[model samples]
Target chain A: MKEEIIISGFGGQGVLSMGKILAYSALLENKEVSWMPAYGPEQRGGTANVTVIISDELISSPILNSFDTAIILNQQSMDKFEPKIKPGGVLLYDPHGITRAPVRKDIRIHTVDATEIASDMDNSKAFNMIVLGAYLKVLPIVQLKSILEGLRKTLPARHHKLIPMNEQALQAGMDRVK
Target chain B: MKGIHLMKGNEAIAHAAIRCGCDGYFGYPITPQSEILETLMEEKPWESTGMVCLQAESEVAAINMVFGGASCGKKVMTSSSSPGVSLKQEGVSYLCGADLPCLIVNIMRGGPGLGTIQPSQSDYFQSTKGGGHGDYHLIVLAPNSVQEMADFVGLGFDLSFKYRIPALILSDGVIGQMMEKLRLPAFKPRATEEEIARDCPWALSGRTGMRPQNIISSLELDPAIMEKRNLERHERYRKVEATEVRYDTFMCDDAEFLIVAFGCAARICQKSVELLREQGIKAGLLRPITLWPFPKKAIEGYCRQVRSILTVELNSGQMVEDVRLAVDGKVPVGHYGRMGGIVPTPEEIVEALKKNS
Candidate 1:
């Protein structure tokens, strides 16, 4: 199965990192993957995002017109990418930030209080991990173990201790849908 | 030969340079291309493997440093993007004029100004023909994927040494930004310094013993000597065109429509081929891995088998002129592209094919 996901928010909101984690997870799963950011000036405050593609075969291009999954961490992200969700795709939105509703009903829209959840867990940045968890629950493209392994490989040595907390956040988010 | 190790193109290129036994790297930080410097900085191959990495004060200094390093008969490399590469052109011209061996990589971003930091193939003519000036050619290698991105550094260096000419790895935003698994290759050291000195008597290393000191300059003031030098460079170019043109042909043997593209543009063209195939249109991608030497022979051969050739690029059809020249009126050569950081989607390319053909 070929799945394309876009993670978008403000520049410092860990939007790019969220996309990277999924892309890395897919890579660890041995699936063909690609991660491309909206580079240059567009990344300033104007809805920065990354496109990640996971496929059973070689990925041709990183650019995508529509996404199988859209993870919006803010209102601007929701406003920008809401129109481009693929038919019957999924949108995992942070309810605290995204104060909008879906325009179309065909796509599955899961609204999570990710910001509140992260705050309750004593880390606001962990919101990205919560979104990734929701993505994992919905797609299950890679094993949870693979996602953990990806985090181990990708997280910096200084932030190595944050792995377990982020993993806990992921598990908490995954438990939401169940 | 298992190819898979989740790497960015910048990291891949660094590792590839290490595998090619590249003796030195000189560069400064530039967006998109900065990670290349970052990777090599962290890898610290110099202390362990005798490889040298230095961040020069400026792009100009970096490229000139490359000239100084290459002059010592070592496999040296430097990288930059649009603005930074513009600064390095003087050194590039000098390197080419003096017939020095080195590798230069341009992870092209939007340009003509600080156009944007996003990916772009707009540097096509500059890289392929001459970014600097004066009847010089760079052996340009374009890698569309991260795997090829890593592997081409070694290939670029090898070709540079073999021809004593500068070779460029022409990548763009997509190649630089994307991540893919890459199987690191075993490192192999090439010829020794003594062997290179023996091969290149023209190298400017303060000639000693029974030999006159040779000045490595392209300035030939004498008409007769100038003509001879030009003839020699022309001969080398001809040999490169005849023997060194590298390209990949996909379903083009009996293809009815041929799509010619390179670098990141060609990867998109692959999707165009697939889309056209689904639409009952037989189209194939003719990806020129080597932009210079023009891949004329391969393009012309493919032009013969297909009814028409569509040249696609990220620029305003800069490579189309070369395609036209290579096809030489044998077939209809057309152009399709999006410039100024606009990437032409598969549907758009297929539409262009439909309209043009």
Candidate 2:
């Protein structure tokens, strides 16, 4: 099984990291994976996007014009990527700052109020984890254990202290998917 | 031991250089490829493996430093993006003329100038056609995945030493910036001083009164002698072409249409080939791992089977010329590409193939 996923948002929204975590989890499971990021100067404050392809077989191209899943955060991403989602694919997004919702009827669309949810939790940085959780809830391609392990492997040692909080955020995201 | 790890291509290159017991890395940081130098600095291999990693003031300085290390038979390398690579061309020519074995990685960003920081395969002609002056060819390797980025460091050094010529990893921003699962090669400790002395007797390692002083320079005022050396260098390159042609083919036995590309463009073409096959169009891909040798003979061999060919690149159209020359009008060769950091997608490649065929 091959899943091509694209995540896009402002630089600080953890779009790249979200894709990295997914790719890392796929790798940990010994699945073929590739993660490509559009993160040059745009990584400073502009829109940053990442494409992660996880496959049971060898991954062909990390760069794709369309994807099986798209996790879009900001409205700019929603505008650009909503049309790019493959027919019958999944579009998992946060409803915060979205002036216009996805108009596609063919693909499965799920909205998570991750920004509001993280705001409620008083941890703005957990917003990305919440969105990631929402994605996992919709398509549990990777096990929760692998996600935590991937988080451990990806985050620097100084950030290790925040894993429990991040875990809570992931659980919170999962809960909202219902 | 093949250790499994997930990392960006740039990071893998750095880690592999360290793991392969590279003696020195002298490079200036450039975007898309900066992590190569950054990872080396962060690892501080000097503390662990005694691998000296230094940030040179400029790309020219970096290449010259590589030349100095390689002259002493040290496994040394330097890396840069497209424009930065241009800055080191003079040094590259010097390295080639002096017959030093070293690795030079061009993590190509778009441009004839400082085009873009995004990934592009536009440097094909510059890389494969000898960007530096004189008739010299740097053994060029094109890696599509982060795994190859890691694996090619050791391989590049191996070929460099084996051929006694400089080698290049002609990568683009996509392969340099992307992250993927890769198996790190087993750690091979750096060569000992005695081993260096014994293995590279031609090195000017102080001469030590054991033999005549070894002069290391590209200068020979005599034009006839220089022409002879050029002829000799070409012979070495020819030997490499005969022995070191590395390529991979996908579903070519029954293919009627072929797509020729390398590196990231080849990766996309691979998907296009699969998609075309799904639609009942017999398609295959020929991905050349070594770009310098050009895989001319392979393309020539396939001409008997395939009906038409499409050459995809991130450049406007460069390698297509080489492909056309290789096919020699055997099959109608068409070109499709996206320039200035615009990566062509698989769908686009499929369309291009359909239109071209």
Candidate 3:
């Protein structure tokens, strides 16, 4: 089965990064995947987002009008993307940031306190990773070991030590969801 | 081998060019294409693989540098956006006239004058039709993705040297800015200067008294000789039209409607196809990977099968003329798109497809 997801937030919220990490993880799992960002000027600060589509077959389009899931890191993103999520899809949010949750009952909404958890981990920058952790728990689409390995390879050698901490943060977020 | 990376289209082209063994890159710093030079500068392929990269002062100087390197029988290339490419047109026309092989890349932005930095396919006419004066053609390849942005450089360079003509990689700001997963192609060494000179008897490499002096100029003071030259170039273009038209056809075999697009605009058309399929409309896309040798045969073939053909572009119907020529009134061809700075989304294209179908 193919699953398409979009992560939307302000420019620096690591929305594109979340989509990329998931796409890379899906690649490691041997699925055909594509990640495309909302490029050009709109990417500066207004709302930056990326769409990730993972499938068993070749992906025809990189654009997604409707998504299986959406990770909203801010209220603006929630307002912009909430109406676009496919019926019966999922909407994951960060409790520390997103205040106005989607009013739709057709889709499932899972709110996680990612900002607080990252703050507790002594690294607020890992908030995106925390979301990935919670996402892994719900989907189980990729192996945690495989994602950690992908992290090791994707991160630069200089920041290689950050991999384990990020993995820890991911597992912590996964545990919170459980 | 396959994973997402945070890289611009220009950076990907730079990496791909070096690995593809492009003998040299001669270019000036233009906005969108600047990262290509920056990436090449940081990588310094000259130190690793003896690849030559130079930052020329002007677009004229850059294209001249390309001409010089190409005349010596090396696979040289140059890149710029629309305005910069317009400056290099003089050199490009000369390269074509001299029958020298080289590749030129245009990472097109908008405008008849200093347009915005956003993506635009407005240069479709300038690229497809001769940008410079005189009867000459550059084999143009339009790539819609970052993957093709990297991959087509090698193909463009290869075709240039193979055909003894200039090839162009016509891209836009969208493809240049977007990031995606790319498995770097195998690195192949460029053909040596001596190896290339052996095939062409007329290369200008310090001709001795024993050998005839070589002249590289498109101007023929004599009308008959110019006419003959034009005929010879026409013959070459005929061969290219017959053999070098490359395209990607999606779901067109059973299609009732067709969408013709190229470069980044074509990628959106792919999305339109998916949306149309969902709506139970039999739609297809014919993406012309090559812009010049305009994939006329494929369009002609589709004309007999499909009811209507929609030509989508980022310009004000530049390629539509060619599409009409290809279809030749066998079927109705409609042109729909935006110009300046707006990018046509899949939904817009889907609406056009549904209306045309």
Candidate 4:
């Protein structure tokens, strides 16, 4: 099973981090994974994106022209990545910053109000985790338990206390998807 | 065996250096490779393994520090991008002249000047060929994966110490920035002073009064002596080329067309090979793990079978020259590349292969 995914948003929106977490979870499941971010000046408050691929077989290339899943959190990303999604692919978006909705006939499009939910929960930092939860709900590519373990591995030990809150945010995101 | 951990290629190199008992790292910050120094700083290997991680004033100073550390028979290293690596060429040459063992990592980016921070293999000529003055060769290793990024650190150090020659990890920005699952090598302890003395008797370690004074100098005024020294270095290089050439072949047994690449370009070509195979084309890839050695013998072996050779790189075409020399007109050789840090897509590579064929 091979899954190629793209996650994109503004630099501070945790787009790259979400990809990192998914890559980590894939590693926890003993899967081969690669996470490649569009780095350089584009990372400083500009639109940033990452391509993540998880596979049971060896991964040939980390860069790709198309993806099976596109998790877009900003309007610019949506505009840039919508056409790059494969037919019958999954397009998940957070409707907060997106001005244009994704318009594609051959793909499955899902929306989650991740920003509003994070704001309502008074934990705006969990915005990316919530979006990740929505994507996981749709794909279930990796187990939720592995994701929690991934969080433990990624977040510093000093920030371990916030894992429960992040887990809650993830669950909230999963629950919000109808 | 340690379990797998997800890590960026740059971070993996830093961790691997520490685990491999690297005595010191000196570097300046540069895009696409700043993470190497940043990771080393964050880990504070000095506090844990007694490793020295210093942010030098400039790339030149950093490489000179490597020279100083290597002179003392220490497992020292420095990392930089293309432009920064340009600044370190003089010191690299000095290390080569002194026959000092050190690791120099060039996570290459677009160049000629301060070109761009994106990934590029433009430094192939600078790295494999001599970047600095004089006839010298650095043992260059190209890593295509984050796991190889980690593994090559130890391997590079081992080969450097074994040959008393500097080794280079000639990677690019993509391999430096990308994250992937890797199993780190087991931790090895730093060599003790006695071990260092025993291994590197010519080191600049303070004389114990038992042996004659060990002088570390590359300067020689006498023409005959200099020529003799040059001969000695050339002999060592010949030995390296004979015994240390390394490369990997993918689906080359029955391939009609072979693509030659290294580092990130090689990874992309691997994908392109798969794509071409799906189209009923018998394409293959030959990736040189050691760039300086060029894997010429392996390329020669494949040239007898493959109808044509296509060399793909992130640069305009540097390694293609080596491939051509290896083929030696046995087969037609072509090149495909993108300059200014533009990576060619797999589809583009496939198209180039078909056109060249």
* lDDT per residue (tens digit) for residues B1-357 in model 4: 147788899999999999999999999999999889999999999999999999999999999999999999999999999999999999998899889999999999997799999999999899888999888999999999999999999999999999888999999999999998888989999998999989999998788867998878889899999999999999999999999999998999899999998999889899999999999999999999999888998999987788999999998889999988988999999999999878888899999999999
Ranked candidates (lDDT, high to low): 4, 2, 1, 3
> Which is superior by TM-score, 3 or 4?
4
The number of the candidate with the highest DockQ is: 4
What local lDDT does model 1 show for residue B325? 94
- Scored by CA lDDT, what does every candidate get? 0.85, 0.91, 0.83, 0.92
Q: Of 1 and 4, which scores higher on lDDT?
A: 4
- Tens-digit lDDT track of model 1 for B137-241: 999999988899988988888788788889999999788877776777777875576776787677765566758777777677899988888789888888888
Error at B280, model 4, angstroms: 0.9
Q: What does fnat come to for each candidate?
A: 0.54, 0.80, 0.35, 0.78
Tell me the tens digit of each residue's lDDT in model 2 across A119-146.
9999999999999999999999999899
Considering summed lDDT, which 10 consecutive residues are worst modelled in model 1 chain B? B201-210
Which parts of model 2 have CA positions greater than 4 angstroms off?
Answer: none
Candidate 1 backbone collisions, by pair? B5-B181, B5-B182, B6-B181, B119-B173
The true-versus-predicted C-alpha distance at residue B330 of model 4, in Å, is: 1.4
Which pairs, if any, clash in model 3?
none
- State TM-scores per candidate: 0.94, 0.98, 0.92, 0.98
Q: Quick one: RMSD of model 1?
A: 2.2
TM-score of chain A of each: 0.92, 0.96, 0.94, 0.97
Of models 2 and 4, which has the larger DockQ? 4
